[model samples]
Target: MVFAPGEKPGLEQDEVKLQKASKQIVQTAILRALQQVSQESQQRQAPPKGGPSLQLERGKLTKKHEKK
Candidate 1:
């Protein structure tokens, strides 16, 4: 392909549009990744769901139907 004087090759309007679209795609991916990281950090900082755990002490229970 031949270009007129003072004309830069490989930088046509279509190429500029393509470059812009590629940049936007990269930016969107980065933004999504950052959002995911932020959400994970927030979840980690949040408290655990449900009530506290239950524990049994030593000798706390006896076998049922056992003779005295």
Candidate 2:
């Protein structure tokens, strides 16, 4: 389709506007996904709080001898 001489620039401007809007939308989606992944990773890496502590002792046990 051939547009009138005056209509060609308008069509180009509309296309440019559409492209800009699409780019903005894609950027927003990527940022949101990245933020969500970061939050999830942080949550997973965090240690649990208020838990019991464990201790290990190294020793040798001696058996008691009983005499009749």
Candidate 3:
């Protein structure tokens, strides 16, 4: 099909749109992966909820044993 002057062919337009959509999808996937990795790293760096409590309990037990 012949396009008028200064107009793009339908197939060219469709290809451009497809390229843009694929790029966006790839970007989104990369961002999600990075976010997941960051969350996992943070979780590893942060202590568990039970950590402080366990430490406190151990300290108490030590004091009690020392008193004997």
How does each model score on lDDT? 0.72, 0.71, 0.71
Candidate 1: where is the Cα deviation over 4 Å? 1-11, 51-68
Instruction: Indicate the worst ten consecutive residues by lDDT in candidate 3.
Output: 59-68
lDDT for 52 in candidate 1 is 39
> What would the TM-scores of all predictions be?
0.56, 0.57, 0.60
Please report the TM-score between candidate 2 and the true structure.
0.57
lDDT of 2 by residue, 22-63 (tens): 999999999999999998677556634555322223664343
- Candidate structures ordered by lDDT, highest first: 1, 2, 3
> All predictions: root-mean-square deviation over Cα?
13.4, 15.7, 10.9
Count of backbone clashes, every candidate in sequence: 0, 0, 0
**Tens digits of per-residue lDDT for model 3, 8-33:** 76878798999999999999999999
TM-score (C-alpha, index-matched) for candidate 1: 0.56
- Model 1 residue 47 lDDT? 35
Indicate the TM-score of model 3: 0.60
